[model samples]
Target: MASEDLKTIIENLQKKGKMAFLEKTTPEKIEAFEKENAVTLPEKYKAWLLYSDGGELFLPAGVQFYGIEHKPLLNVNCEDRPSDDYVVIGALASGDPILFKKNSEEVAIYNLEGGKIEEDEKYSDFDAFLIDLPSGILGIGE
Candidate 1:
């Protein structure tokens, strides 16, 4: 579907209380994101971009703007080295949350809500991380 059409669908979903976090994104910014991460995004994720750009893809109540651009804060910290395939994006859940992963590599979910990282063994990789966003999974724990 076209970006505008997708926006409407997302908006409607939000109205029905079935979705959370919707953010707008430009094609230029998408290209910039790929360039910065040195990795191509997955088709499902691209479809998401076609629908919206940055902030909250699903939730509305907990969403907030960090700057004039309204970009959501995405934090990714690697212990050893920065992998070539890492891309972080905002995702929909109970609220607008940041999703991240290492290129095509698998990532462990770490919940930082309790002032600590909690790991979920079932999820792995960047794609998996995105898939599990609704469940409040962050990334691998230290």
Candidate 2:
């Protein structure tokens, strides 16, 4: 889906009261975050951050996103995730994390506990990932 489509999706969700924004981060802040982490945030993911920073989704879909994080805790928070190469962008209620490669926009699901790869899915970019979020897990589905 295009960026406009994503906006419409978010707008539609907002009308249903399932959208919430964590905070908005400035370009300088996000750039600082990238410098601190020594990784470049994917363009699409960065746009998502500049759009809403991050927040939660419920009802039709459920995810607590770790966006650019409006505060100064982006580095610390990302480091707290399971792996260094996989940044936890969002997660399911089961605690499985939805990760994105540090240097790539590609997305994936890595089960931390069971150590099993349930989906083995990959998306070219963050937009594709969001537009095609799978259903039936942690309340998010097709």
By lDDT, the best candidate is 2
* TM-score of candidate 2 relative to the true fold: 0.74
Please provide, for model 2 over 91-134, each residue's C-alpha lDDT reduced to its tens digit, 9 standing for 90 to 100: 65566677677788887777767664455456778777665553
Clashing pairs in 2: 134-141, 135-140, 135-141, 135-142
The sequence of per-residue lDDT tens digits that candidate 1 reaches over residues 1-142 is: 4445455555544554334344556567667766764556654455565454444433344322121124543333322222323333432233322333444444432233442223553244434444444345422122
lDDT of candidate model 1 versus the reference:
0.41
| Candidate 1, residue 117: how far the Cα is off, in Å | 7.3
What's the lDDT for candidate 2? 0.65
Off by over 4 Å in 2: 1-3, 12-17, 59-61, 71-83, 116-120, 134-142
Candidates' lDDT values, in order? 0.41, 0.65
Deviating ranges (above 4 Å) for candidate 1:
2-28, 57-70, 73-87, 91-97, 105-109, 113-142
